[model samples]
Structures are given as C-alpha cells and as structure tokens.
Target: MRRVPESAEAARTLVRTALAAWGQRDLIEDAALVITALVSNAVHHARLESIRVIVTRPSEKCVRLGVVDRSRNIPYLRTDSDGDNTRGRGLLLVDALTDRWGTDRYRWGKQVWGELTCD
Candidate 1:
C-alpha cells in the first residue's frame, strides 16, 4: 500500500478480509488495530513510495500481521509515566493486544509484526 495515512484503513481492510478467510475471525478486532498502528508508523516515518501489508495464518492457532518498509528504524514504546505525552503509545497498544510482537531488520528494509493466537 502507499505510504499515506489513508493506507492504514486499507491495511485494516486487508487484515479483516484475511482473518475472515482464514477462519480466524476471533483475531480480527485486535489484528485490525495492530495493523493500523503498524501501518501508521510506517506511513508517517518510512521514506518510500509504498509499504507492504502482510497477513498470514502461520499456524492454525495463530495469525500474523505485519507492515514492511524501507526504513531500518525500529519501533519503541513511549514510557510516559505521567501519560501527558500523546505520541509513542502505538507500540504500547500493539504490545498489549498481541501475544508477541517485534521487528525483523533486513538489508532491504524491515518488517514490524505482531501475532495473535488462540488460547
């Protein structure tokens, strides 16, 4: 998808469709939020014409959602103890919702991903 704010919605749609198709409907809500946050970060920060959105059921019990960009910058949480800062909470929210989340740095770029698994 294009590296634009509107692409976040498009990413959410792709996640929603993929989850339903994979019979992983239970993950759709959190997955959508995860994808949106990831996409928003890439769109806002990455210097590229487009970013890629990935949605895959890596296992029958797990769904993986990711956003790929050409930026090597990794994401970090904003630990605002006072909750006064409005920025940097995206990763915190993603961390709260996903079973596991991290980034894969590559020669070309990086993939920031999160996973949801059935309990």
Candidate 2:
C-alpha cells in the first residue's frame, strides 16, 4: 500500500472487510484499530513510500495483522508522552486492544504484528 496518510484508513477498511467476510465481525473494530496504528507508525516513522499489510488467521479464534515497512526501527510505547498529545498514542492503543503484539526485524526492514481474538 502507498505510505500516504490515507493508508491507515485504507488498511482499516481492508481489515474490516476481511474480518466480516471471514465471519469474524466481532473483531473488526479492534482489528481496525490495531491495523491503523501499525500502518500509521510505518507511514509516519519509517517514512516508506510503500508498505505492506498482511492479515491471516493462525487459528479458529484469532486473527493476525501485520504491517511491513522499509525501516528496521522497532516501535516502543511512549510512556513519557503527554496525556493530551495526539501523535504518540498509536502503540499504546495497539497494546491495549490487541491480545498479543510484537515486532520482527529483517535485513530489508521490520514488520509489526498484532493479534486479535474473535471469540
């Protein structure tokens, strides 16, 4: 996907549609939130012109969403960010909503993934 500002919303819509089609509509909102956070982080921090969003079902009750970018910088929660700050809350939201999340580094770049439970 293009790493523009709109990519976040586009990823959300893609995750939402995929979840609905897979009969996992219960996970749509949480999945969308996580996907948006991951995509936004890739776009804003990695500064990649293009990114990749991958969604897969690893089990009957869980869905995994991953965002790949061209930078190896791993994301961390900004505990020092001001409560009113808008720019630093993406990873925090991802941590709160996802069942499990982590980052993987590759020679080319990094991929951040989050899992949501449909149950």
Winner by lDDT: 2
RMSD for each of the candidates = 1.4, 1.2
Tens-place lDDT per residue, model 2, 1-119, is 89987988889888988898999988888888899889888889886589999999999888999999989888998888587779988989999999889998999999999998877
Clashes per candidate (backbone, < 3 Å)? 0, 0
lDDT of 1 at 83: 61
lDDT, candidates in the order shown: 0.88, 0.89
Error of 2 at 65 (Å): 0.9
The local lDDT score (0 to 100) that residue 53 gets in candidate 2 is: 96
Between which residue pairs do clashes occur in model 1? none
TM-score of 1: 0.93
